[model samples]
Target: NESVWTADQNEEMSNTSASPDSVSLADVSAEKATQGSDTDLEVEDPEKAFAGVMGAELYLEACRLTEVVPVSHFIQNLSKPYVNLNHHGLGPKGVKAIAIALVSNGTITHLELEDNCILAEGAIYIAEMLRENSSLQELNISNNHLDTAGAEAIASLLLDNMSYLHALQLSGGLYALKQSHCVCTFVSLQGNYQVKELDLSHNGFSEKGGQLLGQMLARNTTLEILDLSWNHLSRKGTVALGTGLRGNGALKILNLSWNGIGNEGALALGEALKVNNVLVHLDISNNQINNEGAKNLCRGLEVNGKLKILKMANNPLTVEGATALLASVRKNHNCMMEEINISNVLVNETFIKLLDLVCRMRPELDVIHGEVEGCITKIPKQHPNPMKVIQKYLKEHNLQLWDFFRNIDKDGNMKIPVAAFRRAMMQQQNIPLDRVQIGELVRQLDRHRTGIVDY
Candidate 1:
């Protein structure tokens, strides 16, 4: 399941100097970087500050610097684990110091530098390093304002590098779904043959980028997980991706949450699911799907028994939609689903009764009814106040408030909707809502509803 791949870095050295206004971290050395000497690896008494610098120095040596000191770059020395510097008061230098450590650290597999205020230059420096490094597996540099130029720099590296990374998380980067339409469609995943997990959630890469990536997935053979959550991929984008899935066989997990995909998109994906058997998990929460979309997906669920998890908690699913989905689940005996999250979806007595019956029939299935009472209340269904009922249940079950509320969609403007309600239900039920499912539902619920519901 885990493997390491490698390649040499290839790029022309531009005389291009980073902007003076840009925040500068220490620079890398122009030598084949090495780990601390065998002697330095062990120390009886190591000072905290000195340990940080030593870690920095070791980073430079390990990366094999090609430039001299003061090379118009970041960190000059390294010693500590790159990820441990996530403390308060870490400035650009501190950040750069950490990145330097990451670029060379052999033990670190995941580096999350999202929202660290890293600019194009910093990104370029790291991009150059990542092009050659093989140990790091997951890199998250999202929300750092990487424009097209910055994005392109990393893309260029990805276009050539034989990296060991199977997962790359760059959500909420400079690309905004609608805004990134004009950006050059140069981002490529063709070279990342071994990558299995990719999260481009909240980046502005709209349908165009989605299409590009979908096409890439069709040709690439190793990827099994792709998360395009929160990129506002509409029906057009969903259609484009569905076309790719028709032929792709390696993918097992696909997350397209919060993309405003309506019934049309759901239908397209459902059609693909009917024919494609490899995918095991699909998250389509917090989109524009309503009862009609749910019915389409339900049709697929009835016919496609391979999917073990189907998330449609959010979007516009109502009582009708929930019943539709439940009907499909009940009809499909081959559905190996062990969990279902239907939080905040206006789940009335109709849906709740059906779900309870399903649970009774299938003892192995776990069902979450986050705010089921509240959803029921919306349509004059028979139920007490959802919040009160939930509170009482938690009290009876000895569930903590945090655990109860962790699943509620904290992103909605109004009360319980499907997505928010679904996730909260999952948290309380102790079922794992796919990360992408939670991410999408979280964005659709009101903030006030977050972190309060319990078992």
Candidate 2:
């Protein structure tokens, strides 16, 4: 069958209120036969049909059917390839109408509906629409009140073979609702092969949520960039994620800033870096990593070759840690690292000299550090021994060291848990021992690695 409708004829048909029942099958056959030949129809413009069905008309019809107010701005922007209706207050009913209108749409490729108060129901409606539509490539629904069910529905869409989504942003609302575990649905991405970029920042993911994400990263192969910033992934969670990174081969850029992953987490990541060679950019700034963590990371940097950018700014690092990192870069002949950011750490002359040497060796490398404190012309001041510091504190307080140990050892046994020893040291404000010094004291007193120290 061949039907060639002119512009005028198409306009007339769009203006008409006639229902399909008004035209019989015989009438349609006769019109098709009189309009044009099959050869003529083969040359017709494919977009003609889409142009004639106005987006505004389709949206209005959907609004009427759903009993929701139609957004005039949304209708005006529907013809655009990227439609941003962020903060438009489109609740469940409003989004349902838009979803219906967009089901058959072929023009829009990107959609942003952030901060619209669209809850789980709205997310379900969007998931249903995506199941039938294949034109959208990017979707940002951040700040919507999507609970566990809603998140699962959206994640399930990724498993469909026909879905074309490449980038999805679902940050900012789950945390406020105390439903951070909703991110567990992302584990479905383990079987997905289309999504390349995912943003789950500000979700306040707990240790369990981190464990679930680790499971996903361990198996997903198509994901290239992931953003997990501004969450609460402490040491245990971070350690779990690092274990996943050891096996991942496709991730290129990862953001774990502001997650408070301390030295133990840094050690786990160092182990991962020793085996992973695909990651190119890493951001672990503001993670509370100190000298010990920096040294642990350097161990990995000395052997890895694929990483290019390392950002560790705003961390509590000193000259010794900074020097170690630079020296590691110099040792790795195959290292492709180009930039290392430690912006807030103050460096001394020794660190500066080492950085200069590393730069001379690899002219392309850029290291960002804070201003130099001072030049070290003589031997640097050694750290005060924890034992000596404790003795001095006891002498000033007129307290005997044996009495202090007896008080700590309440059970009359010579041994006391390391935690109790640390607590006793912390309570004496005059002890003047920082956490690092306290750790050193524990190490020196408990030489056997036992949980208890012999008082």
Clashes per candidate (backbone, < 3 Å): 48, 0
Give RMSD to native, each candidate. Answer: 12.3, 21.0
Candidate 2 structure quality by residue, lDDT tens digits, 328-445: 8999999888678898988876777776676556655657788778634566656799999978878988999897788778788989876567657655566677544666788799
Candidate 1 all-Cα RMSD: 12.3
| lDDT tens digits by residue: candidate 1, 338-403 | 555667566665666777677545544545545555654366534344455555777888887565
All candidates' lDDT scores? 0.58, 0.75
TM-score of model 1 relative to the true fold?
A: 0.63
TM-score of each: 0.63, 0.69
Worst 10 residues of 1 by lDDT: 1-10
Candidate with top TM-score is 2
Candidate 1 structure lDDT: 0.58
